[model samples]
Target chain A: MKTIESRSNPLYKQLFKWQSSAGRRDEPILLEGVHLCEAFLALGRQPQYALFDQTRITEPHLAGLIENLSEEVCCLLPAGLLANLSNVDTGQGVLFVVRPAVATLPTHLNANMLWLDRVQDPGNVGTLLRTAAAAGITRVLASTGTASLWSPKVLRSGQGVHFGMHLHEHIDLLAVARTLVVPLIVTTLSEANDLFEVELPVQAAWVFGHEGQGVSQSLIDLAALRIRIDHAQAVDSLNVTAAAAICLFEQRRQHR
Target chain B: MKTIESRSNPLYKQLFKWQSSAGRRDEPILLEGVHLCEAFLALGRQPQYALFDQTRITEPHLAGLIENLSEEVCCLLPAGLLANLSNVDTGQGVLFVVRPAVATLPTHLNANMLWLDRVQDPGNVGTLLRTAAAAGITRVLASTGTASLWSPKVLRSGQGVHFGMHLHEHIDLLAVARTLVVPLIVTTLSEANDLFEVELPVQAAWVFGHEGQGVSQSLIDLAALRIRIDHAQAVDSLNVTAAAAICLFEQRRQHR
Candidate 1:
């Protein structure tokens, strides 16, 4: 195993940038925890290098897993230093640095998709990604005000589903409207047809908006339809992620 | 405005206990932020007292709202001191201490309900409550291990919907199961009938478990039915709140 000590190790600086704001540099993404490392490899993606805390690999299971990684891609660091690489408490002791997967918009699209408009919370953004992937609606377009998709907080909450989808961030809603061949349906709580009452198009693009605001005005105006899921009348509306799931699952339900 | 200065003041101590953990005292439940205060009043509930930060309540709208809160219940504290009661970086500078509303279980119940089995994270617990209320689920029973239903974190995430639903926490699942007349359905990702393929009972009790563990074994065994929501095969499962929304809405969908 190769050792890298000191935060000034150019390598550590690079890792920090990649972990916090990989989108800024178009560089390798830093994935922490054994689960994510396994997910990355499971997707048949190779990492630039895998780091492990030599002192923390005492558990037979962890040791065996670390030993399996080829020496060429293995780098060892002190346990405390490695822990600093993770946001999680009692760190997972392993990390993988991989190139961000390229996301291409399908030239001829028919499948349902998800569009996020200015959704700021990283956990909500990431959880939406996981929900999108799980619902098999993989193509996601996020607007400029949305949280950066490649940030570590999003990745951790996303649980490695990044490899499963085509995510395009910093997208213009007008550009999407011009290119999309299917109905652009926006989910809102007010002045919309009940989701159950409306006939969902077999293939459409669904838009969910910011926590505080409904879909941005421009996008809502361009929407072919607006649908609202009926809940208890007293409460204002559903949480963004909850609304996303209900909408995505409704789409799935219709197709199924 | 009546003043409260010293942290050692007995009134401040009582307020702190109510804000952080009041379930033990069977006393007043605290509400924070201007939105929650408005909701509580809109529901026709009166708080024992409303507290505001002298310095932070500058916005005309906020000031007017606070002024309308009735002089009998108005209490003022210094800005920094009031901010200490909040978890957010910038406090909203308003809090209401309302007696916990008595929630009575329905006799000979026919409406669908949701149950929380030791779901511990305050955010998840709160979000679940919000989801349940929005989905027209009025009755919720939570296990003893679940986070206190009225904790500030849960209250904030609930976004004022806590008042719309009947939340009974620190409960014994076994006792509820014995008393429930509706079919109890436990959600699990493991072996079970696919949610899409199965016939969902329009009026039933749905159990969502802790984050790491799915539905507990005893609850699973006691359940009248076990259902699994189908997601993309690669991912483990959806977030519990997302899962709850899907399940509850599916029930609503079927009956609607």
Candidate 2:
């Protein structure tokens, strides 16, 4: 029921700051739109605050979402203010600021996971997470050069899968590779086994790298297997997200 | 070299118009960055005009690219002018205006093809085209509701694959589906065969629909088979581009 009209308000300034760049590690991430908020609520995770556009709050869908939230967490913002806080051109009229659940990496990795080495595009990083989650991979590790896992663009691209998975960012991937109990599968451009021809391991860490500069030599040297997705020779390489989907699902098919 | 420093100039105005929206059917499409330009040249196609930033034209890479073109086709623009014509934040200092090669739809469709039904996102549409090309689907048809395939953002995301593919826009997909010789495979959310378990046709028309909406009922009714990619129940569905990659590559794998 609280209405914040001034840009100078402490809460509004904090929201604005969090929307721009990677905030402090512990800061609650900004989740935009009804779908993401619904996803968060489905996980039984409560938002620190739920901000809605005052004019559009009476719309049936937005009102339905409001009824599910605790009255204490709801706040009203003018349409302009709400739009300004949104990353997309058309504001979705609702936003959730939720602190993600903290996760710790296991000492000895035995499960199938994803290692993103400098996957700079936020959309690519987020889609990879979504694909990894759908394919039943529960943990994902990203090097420092990777896009911020909690960035707004990524959260939008990731849809709601971030809730059900363990995400470790700014990781020392090479060090982790050295300590892994499972095979490390690296995808490369050439001189690698065709993905369809190889016998994939049941549980391994799949390493996908930067868009232009692929898997680093250190990780390549440590890979238990190197695979490439064979395509018509016209394309230089598959988009990272596409490659991830094909590889992850192919693994699923093999195990099935 | 001719210098274009004024925004009011006719040539500059024409380039500006082409950059903003879908131009006339016969208008030349804009190709940005060195990679795209190189791709265009590799096809043995020359741009109607190559515009470069005056100051950056002397850079080694740009200069080398310049050597391949006839001096009559080149023009220089002030940095500010050239940057204004770019879509990305950092302009690559080059842009090409070239009329795309005309393509006609075959009356009796037998080859593997892609039918995009109201796939509105430029990035998604473009990425789909690139994926189709890489998977060896030579022909792509898009309904009117789909994003303009020749738009700048689609061209950028498509990389250079547009040059090699036969792209038909503003299509009546239902009409085409009715006359198809090969099977029409529709991707659906539920009540469909699992993609991996099904016997995929070697030559089929794969229909990927809008982002939020699955394939239309009309298309679904005409489908020889409806297939869905099975994934974890936690997430709603795979991103369209990701879904296309999985489906296309799976077909390729089975055929091989």
Candidate 3:
């Protein structure tokens, strides 16, 4: 194993850029911890590079992982240097730089697509992606205000589901809604129609909005149906991530 | 405005302890950011104390919040001191110390209670609480392995739902389930009954498990019904938070 100790080392600088950059402009996204690295390997996707501290090389599971990697794909850095590259305070001592998947909007429409409008929280965005994948959704359209799908926080929250779906970022949500032939259902707290009472479309696009605001007026007006999950008197709204899961699951249940 | 500059100040130490000690011992939960603090006030609960960065006291919305606070409840800290007390890297420039509500198990619960088994993630635990409240579920019993309900992370995830419910953390789930007169419905991946097909009980306790391990054997054996949310081919399981919302909503739909 080769170890680079200097924080100013070119490799360390690249790792820093990978963690902090908004988009994959010049650097690949960084996947930290062994769980994600194993997920990458299981998918047969070669990471651009793997960096680990020398101490981690002694652990059985990590050592096995390192031995399984192709020589060209592995690199070692000092513990302090690796820590500096981690977004979380406590780094598990392994980080992988992987090329972000080339995501696009689906050309052929399916009845089930998730539209996220200005959903700002990274954890919420990531949880939505996981829910979408669980409900067998294949494509997601994220508007300008939505969190970057490839950011480290979002990637970690998604837990490798990012590699499973088609994710198009910074899209014109209203334009995409207008182009779709399938029924577009938007979730809203103001809607009088309860989700369970409304007949879900066989093939439809589901749109979810920001945490505080429901779907934007432009998108809400474009919707074929406005649905709400009936709630008790105490709560104002469900957490956005929780709402996404419920909406997607309801649609899947109806289609079944 | 009152300014406290010393990091060694007792107020600073207490805030730091509340922020860092999620796993160790029980303490008053810390609520960060202005939005949550505002929500707390709207609910008619007074904070033990509030710390604000002196510079941020000038921002209009924040200034309004400060104005609303009773004079004795507000304490202004130096910008740098406020930065040190904050858990999030970009602090919303306000923090509140509030006593977490003490939650109790319902002795004569007639269904409509939630039993969580070893849900390790604080965010999931919090989201479950919020969903539980929205579904009109007043009682939640968390097994010993479940994340602490009063943890700063869970409290933040619950988004103030803790105050609205009867929450019992660190309990023997199987023993409690055995004592209940209502049917125990446990959610599992291997269940024969699809959640939508089952006649959901209006007054039954719904039990959910960890993300990785389905409900434990003891709890499984205690359950009168085991149910699953059917998904399309290739998808395995839904995230626990999403699963909780769907299950809760389904039960609510059946009763309504």
**Docking quality (DockQ) for each candidate:** 0.77, 0.82, 0.63
Global lDDT of each model? 0.82, 0.89, 0.81
lDDT for model 2, please.
Answer: 0.89
Candidate 2, residue B105: lDDT: 87
Q: Say which candidate scores most in DockQ.
A: 2
Rank list by TM-score: 2, 1, 3
For candidate 2, write residues A1-256 as lDDT tens digits.
7788989989999889887754347777788899989988988877899999999998987998898899989999999898888877887799988887778998988999999999998888989999998899989999989998888878888998888889998899999999899999999976799999999999999999998898898999999999999999778878888899999999999998
Model 1 Cα lDDT, one tens digit per residue, B1-256: 6889979878888888766765553778777788888877877767898888877667775686675677878888988778777667876788788876677666565667778998988888888988888877888888889888887788888888877678777777877787778899999866788777778887888899998787899989888888888887758889888898888888888877
Provide candidate 1's TM-score on chain A.
Answer: 0.92
What DockQ results for candidate 2? 0.82
Q: Which segments of candidate 2 are over 4 A away from where they belong?
A: A21-24, B22-24
Clashing pairs in 1: none
lDDT of 3 at B179: 84
Q: Give model 3's docking category.
A: medium
What is the C-alpha lDDT profile of model 3 across B38-107, one tens digit per residue?
8788777888888888888889868878877887888888888777766678888888878767755667
Separate clash counts for every candidate: 0, 0, 4
Lowest-sum lDDT 10-residue window in model 1 chain B: B17-26
Candidate with more favorable, higher TM-score: 2 or 3 = 2
